[model samples]
Target chain A: MTKAKVYHDGAVSGARRAVDAVMTVLLAALCIVWIYPVFLILINSLKAETAISTTSVFELPTAASFVGLGNYIYGITKLNFLSSFCYSLIITVTSVVLILLCCSMCGWYITRVPGIFSQAMYLLCVFSMVVPFQMVMFTLSKTADSLRLNTPFNIAIIYLGFGAGLAVFMFTGFMKSVPIAVEEAAMIDGCNALQIFFRIVFPILKPTMISTAILETMWVWNDYLLPTLVLDIKKYRTIPMAIQYFRGSYGKVEMGPMMACIMITVLPIIIMYLFCQKYIIEGVIAGAVKG
Target chain B: MEKAIKKYWPVFLLPTFAAFVIGFIWPFLWGIYLSFHKFVTVSKTTFVGLDNYFSVFSDPTFVSAFWFTAKFTIVSTILINVLAFALALMLTRGLKGTNVFRTVFFLPNLIGGIVLGYIWQILLNGILTNLGLPLLALDAKYGFWGLIILMCWQQIGYMMIIYIAGLQNVPGDLIEAASIDGATSMQTLFKVKLPMVMPSVTICTFLTLTNSFKLFDQNLSLTGGEPAKASQMLALNIYDTIFSRSGAQWKGIGQAKAVIFFLLVVAIALVQLYFTRRKEVQQ
Candidate 1:
């Protein structure tokens, strides 16, 4: 058998295998280090505030004081969870849907019909992408106030504008890979433009659509900036802004419940990521790698 | 030609064009114009020529913030891309459970900047307490590094995914040829693989550099430039100047800064593109 080899070579391979094993273990350990803070927050979130403050965050709850979900319940109630929760949900879903529709239509159009104007429009959009959001925040906010879009719908419009550049870029790139033959086939079959898009093109574009949707959803869901500027009323505060209030009220070091609040805030994103993880990963790789 | 234009163009192009102009183009133009005007509100802006530019240039805090952002973009861009590329190499070695590892590493990224900022603030300050220093300090260096660390952790996996894809697309024959020619793994990487991955590196570097410069939410949540405004980035400084400082009414100044910021980012991005594109070998 080839297994019967030279001793020196065998020893060299053995040492190499050992080195690989050690590196693998080290990588695993580093990943654990990377993610353990999340676990720390999660478990500590379940404990009562007193237990959290007194006990080491690493320790388990005692049988006498195994309070189940108390921290979450109390934290939510104290933080006005219901209103902020609704606000965040409404804003995020609405913005995402609007963004997707606008981006897809624009993406399909600009890519399919190549011209000087569309090219200029596309460059303008690209420029918008690199332009720092803060640069435009003052002007946009003032404009929004002037237009009186300070309502939820207005916030959604701002998001649509902000999100369109990247989404259109992705959609256009993906659309390039889809040949003109498909659309022409539909057209020859007497399909109207709307019919052709809905029946033929959209289904083919599902993967990109899903990728765009997942990415945009995560972005709008967790976004704190636009919402902060637009929705000034205390009643309209989203979860991130609500958490800001909590931070201010509690001052610097309120570990237990504040951590619980953070866990609550991140819950939706974590949940969404769990479901759309693969598509999100694929989208990021495709988009960034190609650039 | 007229008939074809009527038949095909509008069907495919109208919706996107209308949306792009209304949603992005108009606002972007308005944003540029608003920088040169002074007003308590958007509609009320009055053009004031180069006065805003003069004020923005002279402001000490703005100047410091600009330097801070430059330093940040430089260091973090190098650190994030280098580390991410290394991790990409390790993870792409046909290892078991690479997908799971990628997912774990990427989770931080999916979490928003603000959320990640707060989470890391708690986690980091928890450690810093043992060192007898608060997370926010006088020099802002702690917050600066903390941000760099947070940015690196959150961004590495995203960049790694790109790097992995680039590594995969690298011509296998070239790698094999290098190895056959008695090249070590390091030599193969530096001499062969890196040149091929220049496109990916270029894209990743440009993105990280711009992202670092533009970061605001994380900077706000993490430090807010505490202890005498040491950690404020250019974006945050502009934000504070426009909004937080009452009667600063320095819309013109803020706009000047924005204009300058835009020019700098565009210039850097262009230079980076040129340098990287020149080195990109066509397969």
Candidate 2:
């Protein structure tokens, strides 16, 4: 190549490098800003109550203000944090497992069976997707209470109904993409529908199952309004409801423990997220694309 | 196969169908019925016809909340999609440590909305106090922007993931053809990349639109519609009207508002999906 052509190429590549550098710096700055809130809570949780409220939150905790594990202890003991954590865990797991099993089966049935009833069922699940929880919150709670389905353990049934829409929709979409030849062959072997599903189809659906489980787990774990309204609040409180009630009961005086509780609530989810980051990202994409 | 499945319907579908009927269908039908009647609890109800609907329309707080939620939805939806798309573009540029940045940004979305709101409340209040400004709860405008900031933080990462997926799926041949045709980078982005990612745009828009309308936990914990309820959204308004209010009339009115809210969200989501889907290019 001529010298001029080589010089032109160098300049163009230099400009591209400049743009890349600028973007890296900008994204790095934004990440810090994005994580600042969680960091702020973490540091303040270690500070004394007076420091959290009286001093500017930007300051690092001093020897005088540091309370060590005092706030965590208070949160666990006085604030019922342990019970709420367990409740959140139990509720989220049960609801997700129930949603996966039921919705996958329902999705499989509707996809394979071509009839008016199946069509209507699929349509109803799609319709339920758009119905805001507010529309059914009040009456649903009352209904749950009347039927004795208001306990934390049993509320998974309620979530199954509420969450069935998206779960069924997603599962059905994936099911349609699954080749029918496999199922046909399994059927030809004299395998029952249940056996075929458990042995062949269920294993094939592992990816979508992970997607649905992650999506439902996030929703059931973080959900506040439904549990607040439906579950007997006196007897049961999820992490979000528990935190809100904790704040209300303590008012402003217990800011330290509140921060501690917030950290406690957030840490485990973050840890889980770090472990399953791939599935979470893929699950989101799968959910959004199908949704 | 059909006969076998039909025979096993009790095992395959009964549990879900039963739970759905009890959980969603019954409550939904009852809610629609309750919207037209006056009742405090469930048992005692008097037919009120259109009176509850009329009350919802006439209530000034409900009207203001409708506007607030509308404005908030529009602003946040636009901000989130744009920023998310931009970040998606940046992260897809073969940058080093892009994964780490993506993880950092996405961390917020994993946290619950209520916790996010309270965390932001403390942070924003501190900043405002340092600047000698009003607290987030003390003014509707601050509360509005505070909620916006919180939402943008929580959602941009999620929308970015979807957009990244969309961006990655864009055919390399199309981009190569554009560059070969001497298209400027700006032209290649706007004319080539943007149009190809319309599917992602459609999904993100739908998710953001519905989420912004149905938002409650964040609204409750962030502002609680303080300063005389100026910042209340539709969901929070319906909530307060139902649980916090007394008397039979308010309950009916709340149900009416909920039905209206449901219709509004459905209409908007449908329209959005239609328009965006039309723009999606067939691959």
Candidate 3:
């Protein structure tokens, strides 16, 4: 292994090293391209509303164009973006938590018990992942209203339903590889099934749970149409809904405050991602490959 | 273990199963049923077989939207995978600052589609204005290309991460063996590396295909089927059918279109997977 590795890396000639240097520069340039649009949004958020024009958009914000925290304040107070932020946080947290708990438990049942019902449940969860949201948008909205699931807290119940397919699929896939010996030993030790699951299986499933929570949180937080259809917008709005409503509701778009709201929506996620880069990336890889 | 665990089925499975029925199963079955009935609300309905489906075929906007989305899916899928694979290949070459570059590239994937749409709408239109071209919303072709560009920007890094993972798993000895056999770099890439990454190709294509087809929010924010709805996609078409218009017939037709849209996605996805899976080599 070391010989092969040395041939691939240490054996590289000076010319190859030069080529590597040039390639690194090219990759660095592409990184700038990836970041430019987000940077554009950030600078636009700081610019005065009137200063924003199609012609001057790409230019850096000038001293005259800059408005320090002005747009953020306007977005919070005037457009009531803070309430939308709170609602988004509440719904995402509750939904992700509910999905993790219920789906992980269901996955344990499906994996531990071999039976016809368990097989059917597993297949149904798998099938649900493929069905598009548009297929049931209208009917689901009506169902939510009928069931009184249109409120912020109750909507997590709705998310648990839609999110079950992915969450259960992930958990079950992870669980099948886990040995049954631990649970069997627990069962022999005068532990009932509930106690065994809560104490034994749940701890073993922590990595899968965290990854599932991240994936579901990403979806529920950014989801726009589901909330718009199910929730009464007059009462509750997610961050995406608020941004869309902010744009179309005004006769002329409030570009500055709108951009500020976008910044608020994106910053927390970026911060979380940068902090937990390893887990988030691993979660994504595990999800795509495993599924 | 199986018998003992089965005794606690209600405790373990009941909550998720119940929510699944409420959230997905019932709404899905009812939505299909609604497609056949002419009703403003679920309470009042008249059974009308095949009438709404026929109207769906005749509607100019719906027909055009289908073609537009099909074309968009193909172009974006091919571009996204190719560019992402290229980036992955470059980044895996023991380059300096690869981590920083990877983080930056993957940044946009974490942002929501709606936010992505607004960011690009401003930047793309500004570039168009500078170049003395018509706005993106004004022309059908511009709207098509604009969406393709935006999607590639957001999804390439995501697909790149997948591709990178796949590429790193390729046995290094295989590549060295190819080099020892006097194979050219291109030959080694095609014969050795490419086949090894077929699994990633299947995954990336599946993802890009479904995502582009099911896309709604970005299509809504960007262009929004402007220039008289010339650039509308299938999802946006289904949405506008029910909500943008107010009538019993339109709702029925919208439901019908949605059913068709779902089947199209499922069929295409299955076919893509079948062919791609056949090509994937087992390790």
lDDT of 1: 0.76
Per-residue accuracy of model 3 over B1-283 as CA lDDT, tens digit each: 7777788888899999999999999999999999998988789999999999999999999999999999999999999999999999888887889899999988888888888888889889989998989988899888899999999998998899999999999998888787777676689789988999999999999999999999999999888888789999999999999888876699999999999998998898899999999998888
Q: In model 1, what lDDT does residue B50 have?
A: 76
Give model 1's docking category. acceptable
TM-score per prediction, in order, is 0.91, 0.97, 0.97
Worst 10 residues of 3 chain B by lDDT: B176-185
- Which portions of model 2 show Cα errors greater than 4 Å? A1-8, A250-253
Q: Lowest lDDT 10-mer window, candidate 1 chain B?
A: B1-10
Q: Candidate 3 docking category?
A: medium
Summarize candidate 2's per-residue lDDT along B146-255 as a digit string, tens digits. 99999999999999999999989888778877776777778989999999999999999999989998899899998888879999999999999998987769999999
What is the fnat of candidate 2?
0.72
Task: Kindly report which residue stretches of model 1 are placed more than 4 angstroms away from their true locations once superposed.
Answer: A1-12, A47-68, A248-255, B1-19, B137-139
Q: Across residues B110-135, which tens digit of lDDT does each residue of candidate 1 receive?
A: 77777677777766666676566765
